[model samples]
Target: MSMARTVSDTRLIFGRYLRQTLRSKVAVVFGLTQPLLYLLLFGPLLTRLGGVRGFGSGDAWQVFVPGVLVQLALFGAAFVGFGLIGDLRSGVVERLRVTPVSRTALLLGRVLRDTVVLVAQAVVLLGAAFALGLRAPAAGVAVGLLFVVGLAVSVASLSYVLAMRTRSEDAFAPLLSAVTLPLMLLSGILLPMGLAPGWLDAVSRCTPFRYVVDAARAAFRGDYATAAVGEGALVTVVLLVVSVALGARRFRAENA
Candidate 1:
């Protein structure tokens, strides 16, 4: 009964957001345009900038492509929290607080829906990348799905942090770019981390996105290294926990 109620409540919230977003033509365009722009522009541009080191295969754009997809999924999910922050400031959070719906369910549900959409968007981008010579191994589909899952969780958590901690969605808007841009820049998104400056490589080592790239590349190749999986799982778990913690605290404060 409890699980059922939770599911129903979450579904209600998810439907609400999705409906609103879908109704607005501008919103749909903005969301789709992100990956499309990266696909059309960055695909050829990076491929043309000569050879960049690969994770292992040295295919240049191939290794770089997965990271870009991860970045896109992360950024795409960021807007869900922007919606959350907007709702909160406009008293939607307060309204929901007075209802019987679970706060965890409310936030988690949004994350779930947004993550799904982001992953689907990534498929389009990855397809475009392949057309531009970014070929994955035969296991590309499976690999991409796994990578998107890890990415969605990480971004959803970070988005939770943004929505809860920041004063408003507008205030948090620029920070989305701030957070994601570095994750891509530091990670082997456009070039192998080995080619990056020493400090940058060290920093990328600390960034979870780097682990995602490593694990993803391995997964794409069907290599499935234990070390890579462990690292990615660790970071994903830690970040998601932190997000829930912060979100809980903020929700309490808002209702208090």
Candidate 2:
């Protein structure tokens, strides 16, 4: 009965944000524009590089698109905290606190909405990639999409937790950039980590995001059954669990 109530509240909150997003069509288009630009501009230049040292042979788009998709997930989901901060400032969160909605549902609803938005962006990203020259098996493409949504869930939860803790966009924005840039750079989202110096490559192994990027690349290459894919999926699941738990705990503590 308690579980059913939580689910019902989550659906209600989810519907509220889903409708809000639908009303802002420009935000949806702009969320996809960065990846699309990278696909058109930076992508062609990579193809000219012929063979990157550690990257396997393929049309560069096959390699580049997965990286861009993950970047899309990374940048978009990590910034979701800004919206939460806005809610807090506008008293939206304070108003919700008086209601009986599950605190977990509050965080889960926002993260789930973020997941949906990022998945839509990923679809548009893949469409542009296909037009450019990317060709992965449908199953592989599905895997990549799953990876994107998993990443969205994990990142968005963590972002919201940080927003709650900081309670100020001024503090949150720079801190988020500091956290995300290092993760993005070391994760090899743009280039293979193998190309980095031996020690730098070794250091990347410490970041969970590296596993996710590897998993997406494996799926892009149609190597779904590989060990790397298994490790990547494991890392992503663990991240989602830990992040959601942290975010929910923070929300409950704040409201309590």
Candidate 3:
């Protein structure tokens, strides 16, 4: 009964948030601009380095598109906390606190909405990539999207938790920048870490995003059984579990 209630509540909250997102067609289109720019501008340059070692195992499109997808998930979902902070300021969260909604549903619903948006943006990005010459197998692209979903859920949940803690965009924005910038650089989301110096490469291995990027790239190249895929899947699952748990706990505590 509790599980059913949570599912029902999650669907209700997801519908509410998803409806609000649909109302802003401009926001949806603009969200793709950054990744699309990377695909259009930075992507062509990668073609020049097609033969470069450590650029990964496929054409420039394969390597570059996967990295751009990861970047989309990282930058896109990481900023979602700004909306939550807005809600907090406008008393939206406070109003929800008095409702009988399940706390887990509250977090899951928002996360689901985020995951849906990210997936749609990803499809658009992939369509553009195809037009520009990307040609990965259908199954591989599907698997890569699974990674994106995991990434979206993990990052959005944590963003919400962080927003609730800081409860101020002033504090949240700077802190997020500090964290995301390093993660982006170290995770090899632009170029492969293989191109990095040995010590730098070793350090990148310590970051979970690095493994996920490697896995997504590997999937894009049709290398599904590789160690990189396993590691990325494991890291994504662990991160997803931990972040969702933390977000739900924080929501309950805040509303309790």
| Top of the candidates by TM-score | 3
Model 2 CA RMSD to the hidden true structure, in angstroms:
1.4
lDDT of 2 by residue, 1-256 (tens): 2888778888988998888889998988888888888889899888876586787666667677888999999999999999899899999998998888888888888888888889888988888888888888899889988887888899999999899989898999999999999999999888878678999889899998888888888898899899879999999999989998898889888552
Residue 108 in model 2: lDDT: 80
Query: lDDT score of model 1?
Result: 0.69
Model 2 clash number: 0
Q: Which stretches of candidate 2 lie over 4 Å from their true place?
A: 254-256
Error of 3 at 157 (Å): 0.5
Residue pairs whose backbone atoms clash in candidate 2: none
Q: Which residue pairs collide in model 3, if any? A: none
lDDT of 1 by residue, 1-256 (tens): 2878778887888888777766765865678786677667766666555554433554556566666776666667666677777787788777887888876677767777776677667777777767877766767547656766766765776676676777576778888778777777776765667677788888889887787777666566556656876676677667667766665555546442
Model 3 Cα shift for residue 158 (angstroms): 0.6
Where model 3 places Cα greater than 4 Å from the true spot, the runs are 254-256
- Model 3, C-alpha of 57: deviation from truth (Å): 2.0
Find the candidate with the highest lDDT and give its number: 3
**Order of the predicted models by TM-score, top scorer first:** 3, 2, 1
